[model samples]
Target: MSFDSRSVVLSWTPPPRDNNAPITHFSIQILEGEHSDWSRYQSISTQNSDLKYKVPNLKPFTVYSYRVVAINRMGASEPSEPSYLMMTARELPSGKVRISEAYSGKPDSIFVSWDPITQEKIHGEFLGYRVFWKAREEDGELSRQADIKNPNQTKISLSNLRPYTAYVISIQVLNPLGAGPSNTVLVTTKQGVPSTPANLSVTSVSQTDISLSWYKPEHSNGKIIGYRIYYNHGRDAEIYTVNTSSDYNIYNISHLMPFTRYEITVAAITASLEGQRSQPLQIMTDVAGPG
Candidate 1:
């Protein structure tokens, strides 16, 4: 007997006497696995005197055995001895990897976990797993891949990624033959502090108040929640702070001492953290006028 991943071929000698009548046909019986009973599978006509038959559509990585019975004018004869157990060759996996969890645990990285493929789905020897990821806005050709050689590992961390950005991740089971179908998930990195506020300058000035305006930070890692205005009368004087919503980029600092020099700086804030402050801007309030 000979077999492959899906089919088996068997060759047997004819009965010694054909039961005194010419053999008309042969009935083929097959048994699968250990618990299955033998059953009729197919019949072959003896017109060509062929002694070999090929059974098709057998499952891969399975155990099977076969038997043959001779039939003539009188009737069907007794069955022959069963053939030895035969096993089919291994094939590629037929199932897909399933992702269980995917989320951003840090500002610059994402964590992913998945359930391992069952042994029955992995038709061949288990080799490892392959992970593929890329920015959500990037093309598929720009994706990066990592191969984990250990079969026991089911989770991985993808680091060195841009903060507050979306990414697409995929996982697949691997074997010597090839890789199985992959499962995909989308995740976004956690929010990070914004960059320094840009173009800090004095927009207007008066005897007791100063108005300032500035551009948004070049890199706002997340939605800009607000801005912090930091000011002090002099190098040693007490520092005071004021906050403005993201709706306004200009702020007016009132109730200040006239004819006094003030040092000022600005910083952007997100929901999670504050960013670096901008360079200090020095400005003098207008002198007090005669009442």
Candidate 2:
């Protein structure tokens, strides 16, 4: 556990009471420092059953040990062995910050801004700041990688980001002792273009009309607003757009020439970008409608 300039915070697990009486309270005793004596606080343990306390107003750099005991209707149990440790009080930072501004800095970069970690919240020494970020859907805090590692900067430009993607970001303080906890922010990069739709096929065909459907693209990193259907008969090209506010993966085209051959392709669209078109599917219309 880290320490503030004036006090040391001790945290520990309460001894198991399984199949035994539930713990009613605990007593903490101090055996070091200028105030070395049995603890003067009792109900202070009501904060939680996981035993923890902050012994304050002591001089720094002195060794210390804490003794703890559990009490129930049967009376107080014998104390557990004392934990001995000490640290010269050090400074750390705490904050609840957010990305004040985020924009696409370049084709493959995003610039992020944050509120400064105030000097007062810095408990001990003023060292530096760190900016940690990851893809929005990534898992495990220690798995892939972390922060921007800026000494005193409040803003950073993150490069090499995938277009139209979301990222989770955070900021923390660092001193000689260690780094402190940080709050997480969610941000999204600007949209580029969506990946091409795949598996274009004619689900059904009939005289003077044809029905078709397609699968969504592999990298539709943005929202799919609609689809564009392209059809060509010999020389002329025709386009039809399907504005989908709801789920739609199929369409029907009428007024096509009976027994005529046509080529068709499909493309997915987002609010600001159009994805690559699918491979063309050539098909001949039925000589007669299904009767």
Candidate 3:
């Protein structure tokens, strides 16, 4: 018998005693796996006279054995001895690697772990694993990859990631032939402090109030929940603070001394942390007029 990854060919000699009647046909029976019962597979006619038959469409990496029975006009003969066990050649893995755990370890890194492929699904010798990742908002072509040479290593930590951004991660098993289908997961980095507020300017001012306007920070690492405005009349004067929601980019600070020069700075705030303040801008309120 000869076999490959998906088929087997068998050759046999005809029985010496054909009884009184000529041989009608031959029946081929097959057994699969270790404990499977025998079942009829195919039948061959004597007219062909060819002693060899090739069975096709067999599964890869499976165990199989075959037996033959001869039939004549008189009766059917006992089954012949079973052929030696045939094992198909191994192929690529049939199952996907599963991501069991994935989460942000820090503002700039993520931790990931996966479940190993089962032995039965690993059709060939396991070479290793490949991990692929990229920013969720970026294109697939920009993804980065990492190779794990050891099959037992199923966990990895990815660093140098953008804070407060989402990422897509994929894991696949590798064999001599190629990599198997990959499983993917999505994770987001932890919230981080925002960058400094930008473009602090004094839009309009009055004797007792100052109106300020500014642009958002270039890198708002997380959602901007609010902002803090710090202002003081002079270096030694007590600094006062005013808070405003993210919904507004302009704010008016009231109850300031008339004609006083004040140094002011602005900083952005996230739900978890506050960022650096912008460069201070100095402005003088309009002088008081006759009431």
Q: What would the TM-scores of all predictions be?
A: 0.78, 0.60, 0.76
lDDT (10s digit) by residue, model 1, range 203-227: 8999999998887788887778788
lDDT of 2 by residue, 1-291 (tens): 556666767777877763377777677665655355546422234344556677676544445566777777677777778666565465445544445887775545778787766644555565666677777766764422345445456787888777777777676776666677876667787776767776677778888888987777777767888898899899988999998734447789999888888999888888977888887889899896566
Candidate 2 clash figure, as a count: 2
Q: Which of 1 and 2 is the better model by lDDT?
A: 1
Q: Rank order by TM-score, top first?
A: 1, 3, 2
As a whole number from 0 to 100, the lDDT of residue 240 in candidate 3 is 40
Task: Please write out the lDDT profile of model 3 over residues 1-291, one tens digit for every residue.
Answer: 887877888889888898667777777777777666665344433344357777777777788888877877787788889888878788888789989899997999999999878866777678888999999887745889999988778899999999999999999888777888899999999988788877778889999999998877888888887788888875655444445555448888888899999888888888889888889888898899988
Error of 1 at 166 (Å): 1.1
Model 3 root-mean-square deviation: 4.5
Candidate 1 or 2, higher TM-score? Answer: 1
**Deviating ranges (above 4 Å) for candidate 1:** 1-4, 21-50, 61-91, 234-248
lDDT (C-alpha) at residue 64 in model 2: 59
How displaced is residue 27 in candidate 3, in Å?
7.5
